[model samples]
Target: MGSKLGYVYRVLKLGGSLITNKNVPFSFNEELVTNVVNVIKNFKVILVHGGGSFGHYEASLSKENTQTRTVIAMQELNLKILKIFNKENIPVFPLPGRYFTINQVLEILQNNLIPIIYGDILPNGNIISGDDITLTIAKHFHTEALFATDVEGIIINNTAVSLLKSLDDFREIRTSQFDVTGGIREKLRKIFQYKVNSLIFDGRNPTNIYYALSGKRIGTFVEAE
Candidate 1:
């Protein structure tokens, strides 16, 4: 018999909604992260989280440069996430902009260590959103990537839309309607350009992460044409 197929590697780009709350004050959704980590326990995962309610709110209020304030807030949130992951015996390697480069991401992935990154404004005076980094890392490393967002994967008419399954389906729609940070659409565009397959899923349901990691159909798949 042939050798058994090895486990596939996956990188999950988690949205801010997974950690932070808009309605709650200075609090994180620790329970949600705990639940999600439980669901993802079986996989060899590299997690990238978005700077959620806390970072966005603080950045908006500080009147400081977006890069400065956002980076500081994200660092704090990253530690919070690390604490939760540590409680579950999941080793988290925090990757901030200062420590990240394309080569660094590859090295970490090759070592099978789960690296957690987040969206933040880079010191270069540009928004280094997580979506952008996810695409870059996916292309550079030749790995699969997934985006776990609050929504049910690019919705329209209260239903989930599959933009990649049929590119023509979204050809007429304005790109802005689909992305909040202006990076989701760009991520999809890169998916097409680089011939990489990615997915957008409802992170509120932690089991969806298990399905995605298992190579089962459970989310809106974005694939290269």
Candidate 2:
């Protein structure tokens, strides 16, 4: 935490937990989103979000095609996020699955526009989870990747775990517990394939987000070994 403001660009992936309260009803958590935006308003950031209880849970319960329903649900949820960002004058570009790709992420970074993308089933009939998007972005653009998630960090023994300082500690945990259609462990797995630095912090805590982007130790850091 040197100056709390020297990073060139930041990529923030907002977890579903922060935006929605449990499930049902599409509404924004005003305080949480506002706090998060306030923390990083000074820096150029690309925001990505998880489906959370919005599109993912609804699709899972419905009898509709997984891909089709997921796409529609994600589009709706993305709009919700867009509305919130717009109100704050954050200048968000909502890029759905159709527009998601490594090159697209790079282009957004180059243009200095904060992109607010979400995890959704890609148009190719494949699921592109939020964690997948985070890893993809981190791999392409060597910037700090922040995961504002429901859980504080990788949990072990009912406690927050820090694999960034001890990568070997996470080896024994089952991958299933960490998978959220695409989750922290998945992000860590894909991140290990690249040289990018990543972090998993409690999305409920907006201050942690500020610290993470500022290069301070706020959450669990995941790195490639």
Tens-place lDDT digits, model 1, residues 123-222: 6745566766777666654676788876678655566766555454543233322123544555566667767778888888888888877766556777
Global Cα lDDT for candidate 1: 0.68
TM-scores of the models, in the given order? Answer: 0.80, 0.80
Find the 10 residues in a row with the least total lDDT in model 1. 171-180
lDDT, candidate 2, 37-120, per-residue tens: 777677667778887666656556547576777777778878876776678887767777556886676565556567777887
How far in Å is the alpha carbon of 160 misplaced in model 2?
Answer: 1.5
lDDT score at residue 53, model 2, on the 0-100 scale: 66
